[model samples]
Target chain A: MEWIIIPDKKPDTHVEHIYREKTDKRILKRNPWRDVRLHGTVLVLVIIAELIGTIKIPITKDVAITIMPLIYTIILGLAFYLIKPIKWIHRKQARIAEGAMMLFIGVLIAKLAISSGQSIGLIFEMGPALILQEIGHLATILVLPIALLLGFKKEAIGMTNSIGREPNVAVVVDKYGFNSPESRGVFAIFIIGTVIGTIFISFLVTFSLSFLPLHPYAFAMASGVGSASMNAAAIGPTLAAFPGMETQIEAFAGFSNLLSFCVGIYIVIFIALPLTERVYDWLEPKIGRDSIMPEKEDDNNA
Target chain B: MPDLIDSSENVSVHGIFNWILLLFIFSVITAVGNFLGYHHPIEGSLIGMAILSFITLIGVWLERYVPLDISSILYISVIGIIVAFPGMPTSEFVLKYVSQIELLAIVTVFLAYVGIGMGKSWDEFKALGWRAIVITVLVIAATYYGAAIVAHIVLVLTGVPAV
Candidate 1:
C-alpha cells in the first residue's frame, strides 16, 4: 500500500469544498480554474524565497548563509496576513502544498543522498558510536511514561515523537487508523514540528556545537533524522563547525541521515511503538489512568 | 522495466510520463537557480543539476531492490558512492559539485510553504487542545537532550577530540 502523508481531509477541512465556498464570495465566482491561480500564487512566493536564499550574508561567525531563507519565510508569511489579495489566494493553496508533502520528502531525500555515497568511509570509521547515537533518537520514547505521569490524555502519546517525521506519522496512522485516539496527538505535533522543526533543529545543533564539547561529526549525524530540510538545516552549523572539512562532515552526516531515514521507520514501528504501549500500560497501573490521560478531544465543546 | 516500475501500485503510463516531466522541471529549476545566483555563468550549476537529476533517477529505480523502505536516500547515495568511489568517471564531478549547490536556497522555498501550511491548520491545531502544547514541549526537549546526552557519551567513550 502506498503510504499517504496527506491527512484524511475531514469534512470541515476539505480543500476543494473550502475553495468552492470561498469562490462564491469573490467576484471571480464563475471561475472554475481558481485552483490553478491559487497554486500559481504560492509557487511565485516560493520562487521569491528561492531567489533570496542564494544570497549569503555573514551574521556573526557561524550563522552565515541561512539568514536570507529565514528572513524570506518570515516576510512572505507576514505578507500573507498584511496583503489581502495574496493572503486569500495563499489560503486556498496552503492545504494543497501541505498535501503534496510526500513530493518534497522524496526530493529532499534524493537531493541529500547524492552526498551519501561519498560518506561510506567516514561512516565505517565512526562505527558503533554513530549507531549508538542514532539509537538515542529512540530516547523520544522516554517521554511516554513521563507524559502519562503528568496526566497527559491518551491521544497525546502521538506527540511523544518530536517532529513527527514520516515514519512516526505512518506508524501512528497505521496502528490507530485516521481519527484514532492518538491521531490527534500525532497530527498536532506533526503540524507544530513541520512548521518549526527545521529552524529549531538548526539552532539547536549550532548552539550545541559552539557551547558543548561535541565532536562536530556527531552533530552531523544527528542532523539527518528523517526530514531532509531539517537535516540540511541542522547539518549547516556542523558544516560551519568543521569549516574546511565541510564536504567530509556532510558525507558522514549525509550517511547518518540516510540511515535515520531508511531505518528509523522500522525502529519506531517494531520498537518505539510497542515500547510506548508497554509504557502506557505500566504507567496507568502505577498512576491512576484518569490522572495520566490529558484532556481528551471533546468536539462537543467546540 | 518490470523491476524498474512498481506494479503493486496502480501506475499508469500517464503517471510515468508525469514523473518524467517533473524530473525535467526539477532539473530546469535547479539549473536556472544556479545561473541566477552567480549572474556571470551557468555551467557549474547546470552540470551539477544534470548529474544530480540522473543520480536521483537511479535512486528511484533502485528503490525497489532494497529491503524494507530504503527509499531514495540510501539507494542513490550508495550507487553514487560506488560509481564515484576513489577514481571513477563520475568521481571528479561528484566530488566537485555534489555539495557545491547551495542547499539552503532550495529548501527555503519548502520552508515558506511549510509555514503557510501550518498557519492554515491552526484551527484544527487549536482543536487538539492545551495538552497538545505541553506534549509539544516535552517532545522537543526529550528529542534534543536525549540525542545530546547519547552523542555526548559516545564522543567521550570514543575519545573523539572535542572541538
Candidate 2:
C-alpha cells in the first residue's frame, strides 16, 4: 500500500547554505556602528517597547500571562522588517544585525550568571532538583513517533532530539553530515524556533501556570531549555506570577540554563542521538507515511 | 579545540575590537531600557551595564587566548559567579549595582536584534513547511513540560517545599 496521500519534496538546502554563509568575513569587514539606520530603528523600537511597559492579561482570577516590553520589541522590530514601505533594513543590514545579536546575548548571559553566582547558596540548596531537572530535556526524544507519523523520515531524528539551537545543529551536522536528512530536519526547526519560539514559550509558561499545581521553582528549572531568549521568556511570566521571588526565579532559571549549555550537548550526543536511532528504526516502519502534499502557494506570503 | 576555534573563525583580532564597541552600544541601549521600563536611574544602570560588559569582554578574551575549548558563555558565567559569590569583597558592590538593571531590559535589546535579524531568514522560515512547524512546536512543548514534570516530581521526593 502506497501511503501516497502526500508528495515528498526535497528538503531545501538553501536555508542551510545561508546559515553557514552569514559567518563569512563580510560580517567582520563592516563596522556595525556605520549602520545608522538599523541602529536608529532599533533604538526607537526599544524606547517604544519600554514605554508600553508590562501588560498582564488575566486568564482567570489567579492566573495572568504577562506581556512585557521584551515581547513587544521583538514583534515591533519584526513588523518593521516585514513592512514593505519602510525599506529601512535590507538583507545586508539584517545580516549585520544578526551578527551583532550573538554579541549582545553575552550581556544577558552575564547578568544571569551574576545572579546565579550570587545566589550560589540557593543553587546548592536545590542542587538535587536543579541537577535532576536536566533529564527533562531528554523527554524530547519521546516525541519521535509523532514526527515519524507526520511523514518525516530520518529528519525525525533532528526534529525530536533537541530544540535545534546552534549547538544542537552543529551536533547533528557533525554526526549525520551537513546535507543529510537529519541536518535538514534540525535546520528547519532551528529557523522556526528562532523566529517564534520565544513568543510561544512566554505564553506556554503562563498558560501552564494557570492549571498546574507544580511549584514555580519547578517551572523555573524547566524554563532552562538551553536558549537564552526562551529562558528569559519563561522567566518573565514566572516572575509575574510569584511577585517576590524574582531573584530566586532568575537564579534557578539561570543555573538550569547554564547546566543545559555546559552538559546538554554531551547528553544529545551520547544518549539522545542513540535513542533517536533506535526509536526511528522501531517506529518508522509502523507509523510513517509517504508524504502529505500541501496546496501550491507563495512561500513569500509569510 | 580546533573545531571550536574553526567555528568562531569570524572573530579576528579586529572583530574583537568591534565586538567591544558593539558591547558598549548594547550597554547604552540596555541602560536606557532600564530607565524607562524598570524605573531605575540611568547612572546606576549604566554602571551596572558597564560592569556586565566588562565581565563579558573578559570572557571573550579567555575564549580566544586561553585554549580552554569551552564556550565564552561558560567563562562569562564563572566570572559572574566568582565576583558575586558570598564572602567575596566585591559581592556587595557588584550585586547592588547589577541588580538595579532588570534581566528583561537586557532581553528586550537582545530580542530586538533577533527581530531585525529575522528578516533575512523569513523566506527560509516560510519554506520550512507545516510538518516542520508542527514537530518544532511539539519538541518545544515536550522538552519544556518534560523538564517541568521531572523537576516537580524530584522536588516532591526531596521534600522541598513548593513555592
Candidate 3:
C-alpha cells in the first residue's frame, strides 16, 4: 500500500532499508531485466501450467466448473515462491516482479481493448446496463454492517470504501493519513485482495454460472470490477462456461474494466467514501462493538 | 547489470523504454503459451504480438504528451477501438492475427507474475488477522455478485434474453 513492503523482522541490508523507507528513486533503479532467475522461473511455470491443460470438476450433474492454465500458473508460481528452501526467489526479486507485473499487464490491456473494439456494436447496445453495473461497486458498503457486527470500528470504512486497489489506497492515505486505523484497514485488505482476489473471483464466477439465471453478457459486464487480473479471472471461466460467447464476453468485460479504471476514482471519493462514513456513523451505534482485531503472533496460519 | 543503471533517472525515457522492453518480453513469452495451451502457431502469435505492442506503445506515447490526467488505458482503448472498429483499414488485419492469440494465454502470463510477486507479501498477509481476511472475501463477493445482479436486472428490463 505504501508502494513499500514493511517487514515484520529487523532490516539488515541497504536494499531492505531502501524498501522500508520507500525510496522510489532507488527502488525503481533495480533493473527488472537483471532478475533472470525470476524470468526463467516464469518460463518453467508457464510450461508446466499449459502442459497440465484445463481440468473440469463436476460440481453437480448438470453444471461443471473448470480450471485453466491461468489458474495453474498462479498456483505453481506461488508454490515455488513459498517453498522457503528453494531460494529460487529473493524478496528483492519479488519486488522487481511486482514492478514488472505493471509493465506486462499492458499487453493484456492492448489485446482486450482490440477485442472490445471488435464488439463495439454489442457494447453500445448494452451501454446503459454496462455503465450501471458499476453501481454494483457501491454494494461493497453491504459489508459495513457485517464488519461492525464482527467487531470492526472505523476500519470497516476503509475496508469497504472501495475494492482497495492502488488508487483506492491513495484515497484512504490522502484522507486519513498512513498511520490511521482506516489506512491500516485499507492496506490489510488491499494486500489480501492482490494476493488472493484473482483465484477467489475465478471460482466465484464459475460457481455462480451453474445457479445464476442471469445472461452471460451480464456476468461479463459485471466481471470488470477495475482490477485487470480479477477482470480476466472473471472472464476466463465465463468464456469456458459459454463457449460461443468469447467475443462479446471479452468486449463487455474489457470496456467495463476500462470504465472502472477511468471513472472509479471519482466515484469512490465523492460517493462511496462519504456514503461509507455516513453509514458507519448511523449503523455503528445500532449494531456495533468496541472490539479491535487482536494482534496475535500465535495465529500464523496465512 | 549495466542495463540497470545505463539510463538516466528521468521517468520519461528510462521508464518508457523499460516498459517497452517488458511488453516485448511478455509478448514473446505469451507467444509460447499460445502455442502450447491454445494450439495457435507461434508465428501467428508473434504477428499478433507485434500489432498489439504497436498499439500499446502509441497509446503510452499519447498518454505522456497529451497534457491530460486521463489514464494511459483510455488512450490505448481508444486507439484499439479506432484501428479495429469494423470498417477501419486495419480492422481486418488486426482482428485476424490477434484472434489467433487467445486471451487466456496472456492471462496465464500475467498471473504468473502476480503470483511470484506475491511471495514477499506472505508475512504481511498473515499479519492481517482472521477478521480482515473474512471481511475482504465478503467485500469481493458483494462487489462481483452485486454487479452481476444489477446487470441481470437491466438486461431483463431491456429484453435482452438470458443465455
Candidate 4:
C-alpha cells in the first residue's frame, strides 16, 4: 500500500518579502549600546564638572541650573545627529547646535519653576520664609516621583513590545497564559519569592546601618544601593525638609548618582549574566529537541 | 491519580493574592521604619521592599508557593512611581543646586546605561574581561572614598560645621 501526503500552501510571496525587508531595516537601525555609551559619557562629564565647580559661564545660579539639563539633552541630541564618523569641525558644529536647543528648554523649565515660587535660589537663602512656601516646595519632591513613574511605565511598556520578532506581551501571555491556572500558580510563586528576598535583605541592611554611627551622608549612600532613582526620590526630600541640611542634600544628590552607577555595575555583571545563563540553559534542553543539524549529521555519516 | 495531582497543583498561591500580600508587607515595613525614626522616606521604602523580598523567599520553601507575575509588575511600577515623582521637598533645594542634582541623576542614568550597554560591547572588552571587572570595582571604590575625601576637604576649606 502507498500513502500520499499533501504539504500546506506557502504564505504569500509579497508578504514574506515585506516582512524580510522590515526585519532587515530594524536590524540596521538598532544601536542601543552606542546611544547608551554616548549618553553615559555626557553624564559623566556633567557630574565631574558639577563636582569640581568648573561649569562657569557667568549666568545667574538659577539660570545656570536650568540651563545645565538643557545642555545635557542638547549634547545627547547632537551626539545622535553626528553618530556617524565625521570631521572635527562638523562634530563641533553639531554639539553647538544641540547645546543651544537644550539651553532653551532648560531656561523654559527654570522659568516655570521660578514662576511657581519653587525657585532653588529661594531655598538657599536661610530666612524665615513662611511655613507654606517651604512646605510647598517639599511637596514637589513627592509629586515629581509620580510624573517620573508614569514616564518610565510608558517607556517600559513600549520597550517590552519592541524587542524580538513577536510582541513581548503577547509572547509572554501565550507562553505563560495570562489567566490560565498554571500561569497563575507560577506567578504566585515568583511574587512570593521576590517579596521575601527583598524584605529580608532590606531588613538586614537597615538593621546593620542602624547600629553603625552613620552620618546622613552615609545613610544617603545606603539608600542608593539597589536603584538610584528610588534612593534619590526617598532621601532627597527628607534632606531638603530637615533644617540646615541644604549642603547635605546637594552632596547626596551628587553622590547618589555616582553610587547608582556602581550599583548598576554590580547588577549587570553579577546579577544579569548569571540569571541569563541559567534561563538559556533551562530553555536549551526544550529548544534542542525541535532543532536539527542535518548537515553536520550527514557529514558525520560520510 | 488525577485528583491527587490536581490537589497538589491547587495547593499553590494565587498571583493577585501574593501581590496584595507583598504590598501589605511593604507598607508595614515602611510604617515600622517610619516609627523607628528613619529620616528618609525612600530609605524606608527600600527597607520595606527588601524585607518583603526576604520573607517571600522564605515562604517559597516553607509554603512551597510562589507569586510571580503580579510581583514583577508591582515592583517595577512602585519603582517607576518613585522615580517619576521628582517634585518632592527637595525639588526647590535641588533646583537651587540644580547642577549638582541633575549632574548626579544624569551620571547615574548614564552609568546604568553603560552597565547595560557592556553586554552589547562584550566583544570589545572580552580581551580584558577580568581586568574590566576589577577596574569597574576599583572605580566604584575610588569614587566612594574620593567623594568622602572631597567632602571633607571642602568642609575644611569653607569652614563648614561638621554634622
Candidate 5:
C-alpha cells in the first residue's frame, strides 16, 4: 500500500470557500436566542396555559383534561403554519425547535421515577400484566395496510413504529440510511407526532380509560412505549383519570417504558419490520404506490 | 461569555457553558411554573428542581460515555429516586408536584416548538403529502386501540379486575 505524505498546509482559498458554503451559519453563530422571540412566545403561551389550567375555570375537569391540550396544539400548529410563509424559523431556530421537546423530557421522567421509586413494589407485583401491555405495540402492524392503501411504497415499512420514540426511530434509520425515503417517511411522522401526539394521547387515553374494560394501570403500562415525552403525555391524563392511583400508575408506566426502550429495537428489527415487508408485498399490487416521494426531490435532504 | 458559547459553528456543537446555563434556568423557571400551577410547596419544589437539574447535567455528561439511546430522564429517574428523600427530598418533591401540575401545559410548549420546527420542513411534509396525514392518524389509532386490546386480554387472563 502506498501512503501519500502531504504537507500540513491550510486549504487554498477556493477549497475554503467550497467548505464554507456547505456549512450552515448555525454551526458558526451558535446563538442560543437567535430564535428566542419565537421560542419565547411558545414558552409564554405554556406558562399562561399552565396558569389557566391550575386556577379555577368554568370548564369541568373532564373537558379540561380531554380537550385543553388539543386546543392549544391546534392553535400552535396554525401559528407554525402561518409563520412558515414568512421564513420565521431559520436553520438555527429549527435546530432548537426540534430539540426543545426532549429537553424537558428528563424533568418529567425524573418526577415519574420518583413516584416509581415509591411504588417499586407495585411494579414487581404487577409484573406479567404490565409486560403483556407491550403487546399493544404490535398494533404498529395496522399501519402496514393503511400506509399501502395511502399509496406508500416499500418505505412505508418505516412508519410501523407507533410510539415515535427515538429508539424505534434509531432502529429504522440504522437499517435504512438516514437519507433513504424510508427514513424520511418515519421522520415526518415522528415530527408530526412529537408536535401533536401529546395532546392526542392525553385525549384518547383518558377517553379510553373511561369506557374500556381495562384498568387505568393497563393504559399506564401502555404509556411506556419507549419515549419519555410520550409516556409523560399518556400518563399525565391517566393520573387525572385515576387520581388515587397516580403514583402507582406512573411507576408502572415509567418502568414499562424503560422495558420497552430496551426491547423495542429488537422487536422492530426482527418482528415488526419483516412483518410489514410481507404485508407490503402481499398488498403492493392492490394498494401500494411507486414511491412516497417524487424521484430524488429530497435526495439531498438528510 | 456569549461569544464563547456560540463560538463554534460546525457539525458538532461545543457550547457546554451555554447549555449548562440554559438547562439550569429552564429547570428553575419550569419549577416555578409548576409551583404556580400546582400550588405545591414552592421551596421544596425549587430545591428539588435545582438538584434534578444538576443530576440532569450529570446525565448529559454521562451520555457521552453511554452510546445507547437511553439517557437523561430514566438515568436521572433512578438516581434521583434512590438518592432523594430522607436524604434530600429531591424525588419526593418531584413526585408531589408531578401529579397536580397540568402536563398539557408542559407538553404544549414543546409541541409548539415542534410545530415551529415543522414549519421549516413544510416542503418535505408537502412532498410527503396526504399519505403522511393518513399514515400518522391510522398508526396512532392502531397503537392506542391495539394496546387497549392487549390490556383487555391481559386483565381477563390474569383475573385482575378490569377498570
Candidate 6:
C-alpha cells in the first residue's frame, strides 16, 4: 500500500546518481532477467520431476485419489510462490507466469486425482459442483480481514514498487472540457454505438455457431471468448450439471481462454483504439479545442 | 502541525475500520453463497464485489455527515483472493484451464495498457475530426468479427460438441 506512493515523487537523482548508488558496496545489485531465467528453469525441472515421479509410481486408485488433492495443494502453493513476485512487479507479466504455473498445478492435481481411484466425475460432482450450485455465496466471512491485511502488506513492500505508472492520456481526458450539448450528444452516441456494435458481433457469432455440430467445448470456448471470468465461473456448474460433457467442456474452456489471450491485445489496440479516437474527435469539434485544453492556453498566454 | 497530526490519525483510524467492515461483508456474502449452494465461483465473486461497491457508495454518501475514508487495502485484498481462488480445482483442471485464464489475463492487462497509452485527450480526439471516429468504429468492428471467425474455425476443426 505504501509502495503505491513511491512513483509519485519527482526524483532529482539522475542516471549517474542511480549508477553510483548501485555501485555502493552496501547495495546488492541483481539482474532481474537472470533471476527470472533461473526460476523458469527450476520450475521446468520440478514439473518434469513430478511428471516422471507420478508416471513411475504405480499408484493405486485409492492412493491416487488421496494424493490428488495433496498434489494440487502443493502445486497451488508453488504457483503462489512463483507468481507472488511477478504479480507485484508487473500485473501483465504476472498473468503470463501465473498461467504457466496454473497449467503445471492443474496437471499435477489432475494426475493425482485420477490415480487415486476417484472418478474425475465424482470430484466434479461433490467439491466445486456443490460450491457452484449455491447462488448466494460469500467466502468464509471470519477469515476475510486477515487475508486482506496480509495482502496489503505483501503488495506494499513486494512487487508493487516496480509496476509501471498509469498513462498520461487519462489525466488529459479528465481535464478536457466537453460541456456543450453537441459534444455531450456525440459522446453518448459513441458509447451507444460501441455497445450496439459489440452486442451485434456477439449475436452473429452465436447465430453462426448454431449451425455447427460443435462440442460443448465449443460452447464453453464461446463463453470464454465472450467473457473470461463469466465462462470460468460457469464451467463448474456447467460441468456438474451435465456430467457427461465435463472433459470436453474443460478442454474447450482451456482452449477458449488461450484463444482469447492471443486475440485480446490485438482487438483492444486495433479495435478499441480507433473507436476511442473517433469519439473524442467528434466531440472535440463541437466542444472547441480551446475549451479542451484551457490550461494549455493559459500556459501559452503566460 | 497539530491539526495535520490529528487529521492523519483520523484517516488511519478510518482506514482500519473500513477494512474491518469490508472483511465482514465479503465473508458474509461468500459464506451465505456457500451455504445456499451457489457453486459458480465467479457469481460468488460478483456478488461479493457488488456488495462491497454498494457498501463503499453508501459509506461515501454518509461521508457528508461523518468524515470517513474507505480503505482501498481491503478492496484490493478481496479482489486478489477472488481472482486467485476458484482455480482451486482438482489439479488437472487447474493445470489445463488456469494457464489459459492466466494468458487471457495477461493479454487483457496488456491491451488495457495499450489502450491507456494510445488514449487521446478529448481535445485532441475532437480535433482529429470524423475520420478518427470512423476509423475507431471500423477497427472495433473488424477485430470483433475477426476474433469470432478465428474462434469458429478453431472450434469446427477441433470437432467440439455443439451445445
Tens-digit per-residue lDDT, A1-302, candidate 6: 11112133442111111121121111111211233432333333333323333211224532211121112222333343345453432332222232222212222122122222222343233232222211101111112122123221111111111000111111112223223222222332233222222233333333333344334433444443323222333333334333565444554444433333334333333443344444444543443323222222111111
lDDT of 1 at B33: 47
Encode model 4's per-residue lDDT on A27-128: one tens digit a residue. Answer: 122221223333334444334333333132434433221122222322333343345552232332322222221111122122122222332332233112
Q: Share of real contacts kept by model 6?
A: 0.02
Evaluate residue A153 in candidate 1 and report its C-alpha lDDT on the 0 to 100 scale.
57
Interface RMSD of each: 6.1, 2.8, 2.7, 22.4, 4.8, 21.5
Clashing residue pairs in candidate 3 are none
| Tens-digit per-residue lDDT, B1-163, candidate 1 | 1222222332234433443444444445444544554342456655665566676656654554454655555666677667657666767767676555655444554455455555665566556555555666557656655655676688778787765
Going through the candidates in the order shown, the clash numbers are: 5, 2, 0, 53, 3, 51
DockQ score of the complex predicted as candidate 2: 0.55
Residue B88 of model 1, lDDT score: 68
TM-score of 3: 0.90
Residue-by-residue lDDT tens digits, candidate 1, A27-51: 1221222355433444565566556
For residues B39-121, write the lDDT of model 5, one tens digit per residue: 66656656666655566666655554476645555577767567534345454555554444434434454455555554554
Which sections of candidate 2 miss by over 4 Å? Answer: A1-27, A291-302, B1-13
Question: How much is A275 displaced in model 1, in angstroms?
Answer: 2.8
Instruction: Tell me the spans in candidate 3 whose CA falls farther than 4 Å from its real position.
Output: A1-28, A293-302, B1-8, B12-15, B64-66
Once model 3 is optimally superposed onto the true structure by TM-score, how far is the C-alpha of residue A293 displaced, in angstroms?
4.1
lDDT of 3 at A180: 68
RMSD, one per candidate, in order? 7.2, 6.1, 4.2, 24.5, 7.3, 22.6
For candidate 2 chain A, the 10 contiguous residues with the lowest summed lDDT are A1-10
Number of the candidate with higher TM-score, 1 or 5 = 5
- Worst ten-residue run, lDDT, model 6 chain A? A156-165
Q: Model 6 — interface RMS deviation?
A: 21.5
Question: Can you give the lDDT of residue A96 in candidate 5?
Answer: 56
lDDT of 5: 0.59
Candidate 2 per-residue lDDT over residues B1-163, each given as its tens digit: 1222233454577877777788888888888988988899999998899899999888867776785567778988899989989889989999999999999888888888888887777787787777778888888999999899999998898888975
Q: What is the alpha-carbon RMSD of candidate 1 to the true structure? A: 7.2
lDDT per residue as tens, model 2, A164-213? 88788878887887557787778878888988888888888878988899
